[model samples]
Target chain A: MTSKQQDKDIHQYDIHQKKGFSSEEINAMSQSVLNEKLDNIDAVTLSRLHQARQQAVDAAVLRPSFLQRYWPDRCNLSRSDHPILQPLVLVGLIIFALGTGYLMSHTRTDQLNLGQGEYLANEDDLEVAEDLDFIAWLIEQDKVSDNHAG
Target chain B: MQAQQQRNHLDHFLARVERRAFHLAQLATGQTQPALDIVQDAMLTLSKKYAHKSPSEWGPLFHRILQNKIKDWYRHQSLSQRIIDWFGKKSSVRDEPDDVIQTAVDRQTPLPFERLKNEDLRQALNMAIEKLPRRQQQAFLLRHWEGFSVKQTARVMQCSEGSVKTHVSRATQFLKQQLEGFYHDQ
Candidate 1:
């Protein structure tokens, strides 16, 4: 086909043309084509091609090396053998436990402190009375007279 | 037990498609490690986000995830950077044949190996497919190699069917030209 004809009629070419080329012909044709392309493509590109296939298979197999980043599995454990609650559920449980524990501890601490404060105040009352000076003594004597009248 | 069954189904599905997916990703990235990383990411993302989706939805859903990963990689690497990244850093100083002239060269010459075995031909075809522009390669692979319909290829490539047609056309033309020498020799 002429260049213009090739350009214009290119659309008529079937993407999946499996008609004329035998397996052997296809092989021979592709080899030449590949060799030409490879002449242009470098070794690094070849390496990338190798990695892409390996990686795809690795991911499909769910290898630990591929899964460890997103999964909660211990690096050394087999995923199938060491069954644990799903990571999300584990996180939820931990949060619930921490919240309840904090609330219970906080309430208990508040109660203990209140009891200690009351005990300290009672102990200070006797000391205050014994240490009272003239103003405190007169105030106490007046409080005693008022109690007698009542 | 039900979860286990679901997991089994997913494993089966992935096993069946793994090689093709790997090959597709390899073609896109033109190397293995990044392709592997992208494929791995796509698999995890698909399982996490779409495993609960219907079984029939898996192919397109997995492909969409893969497409997004490819785009993310491309976004990080500029066009020139992509060439360097795919080719190599040290190779930057080496002059490349102008792509336009190379395209002409690719059109006129027979590929070097006209007598390679069938397996080699398939490998060669796969390599040539890889060297194609990203969209054209995807279009060609999805439509011809994978046997997806144009509409399906369009959906996978996230473009209109018309765009798919254009990509396929260009890809076929390039491939034919690239394969012409072998054909003539045969």
Candidate 2:
């Protein structure tokens, strides 16, 4: 048959089938036959099917939840079996420790600098007070000497 | 508690559809082992990825997964076959005769229809369905056998509704042509 003719024939068949002119009945019958065929599958095949299904169920049961499957170690920190998270946690801890050490050292240096500044200021004030006292004592002695000479 | 409920729901859904999914895979691949593997793989994928989806969505989701798995298997087979051919090896795929397709369905027990007493017609119907293009076969099975609506079939097949209707129409036409004698005899 020509391609056009074949197309036309197929279109007609489509219409006829859609109109349910015995085609529907045939479809139902064929479906039932297919169902029976599946029902009566060989024992070996059925056994294999059962095994496959059991395996699937077992796998499904063992399957992790969304959080467990995707985030796994990230979600449940208690589970040590997470291969990816262990290294990640170790690295994170190392970074955190390094950051804290740097910040602590910086803070301590700032405090030490402030303490040194305050100590230097106190020492300078004490030295100035002692110098003032000595100068005052010399003036008093000089005044005593002048009174005696007079 | 919710996790456990979801697992139970997913298990129940897989159990419900396992047989039909197997049959569809079997028909699509025309082999037993590949079909079994496809079904199992589809089940694993559905449970792994989509177990959290609502129960109503599972049907189409599972079928879509199954269909994609079948397509992947076909692509793998063809690619391997091409490599084998390039090496000048006697390709096992080419050695299989076209008529060998009958053996898959012929192994089935007979049906009760008086009109279907002729086993050739039954085999012809099966062969004809198997021989359809992947889209048409998917459209036919999803719409007619699985009773999916055109919209649902489109969703499962990842096609527009118009495409689903066209595929189903063509599938119905071809199936009618192949099984015309049985219908006419009635």
Candidate 3:
């Protein structure tokens, strides 16, 4: 605080004196005003604080996971030295494992489905197979003609 | 279930303390962003290191972390100020973006003394507290505002109980002097 500001504050005190406002009264007034002030803290700051609190709790609350206890550093994959790396890398790996498990499970289910569908002769496949036979005959005839020409 | 319970416990603890922690940081640092950052760092440290401890142990642990953060801020500021002084004199040193408690008096809440009903006393109290020395401010606020006992304040401040008493006594005198214009000298 500047001396000018301090002087201004002192000067303001000169404007009015709640004379003989005892030490106890000063404490009371201080408590009252401060509580009022803290209560009136801006909505934005309170919201920011709410966000910071959640983030702190999430990033720091001790779960004592196997990896966290065994590996003191929690084994980060990220090159950055950000403190949140330990939990984040753990979470990311867990999510990746879950995704891989889901895909592998779905793939087996899909293969079973394909096996069920295999005996059902699709009419389009039948038509393609007939076309393949005709194309093979045409190719053999063309080969014979080419041999003659040679 | 235990994990969820712990989380809820930690969350409630942090919520109960965040506002008071912010207020302490603001008074100590006199800058909004740094105060917020200090509170955040303190919270994170407490959560990371001591969350697994019993709930009863969290209060002193949190207070210690907060005081250390504020001290770190002071040290960092002192170093930066020294470097700036070595370089050159630029009066615009305190040109921070987020105006903290410093702006509360004039700019943020601008009410003329004439129109001041109950606000004048509040405004005067804010100014008096802001004018206090750093340690006294910390001692006074922690003791009276946070309702920590002198022994607890001493523990949080890492000082003797006698020193805590002296600091609080001096702070009370300074505050009373500043507000009531009595007991002029500290």
Which one is best on lDDT? 3
The per-residue C-alpha lDDT of model 2 at residue A119 equals: 50
lDDT ranking, best first: 3, 2, 1
True contacts kept of 2: 0.15
TM-scores for every predicted model: 0.48, 0.61, 0.62
Better by TM-score, candidate 2 or 1:
2
Tens digits of per-residue lDDT, candidate 1, B1-186, equal 655566667767765565566657756765555666787787777666666555677887788688889888777555667777777774431233333432233334444544354554455466566678988887776766556888777778788899999998887777665665454343
Give fnat of each prediction, in order.
Answer: 0.09, 0.15, 0.45
Q: Where is model 2 more than 4 Å wrong at Cα?
A: A1-23, A61-150, B1-5, B92-118
Question: Measured by TM-score, how close is model 3 to the native structure?
Answer: 0.62
Clashes of each: 8, 0, 0
> Which portions of model 3 miss their true places by more than 4 Å?
A1-19, A63-150, B91-117, B181-186
Sort the predicted structures by TM-score, highest score first: 3, 2, 1
RMSD of each: 13.1, 13.4, 16.1
Query: lDDT tens string, model 2, B74-129?
Result: 99989998898899986764344433333344345654544456577767777877
Window of ten residues with lowest summed lDDT in model 2 chain A: A71-80
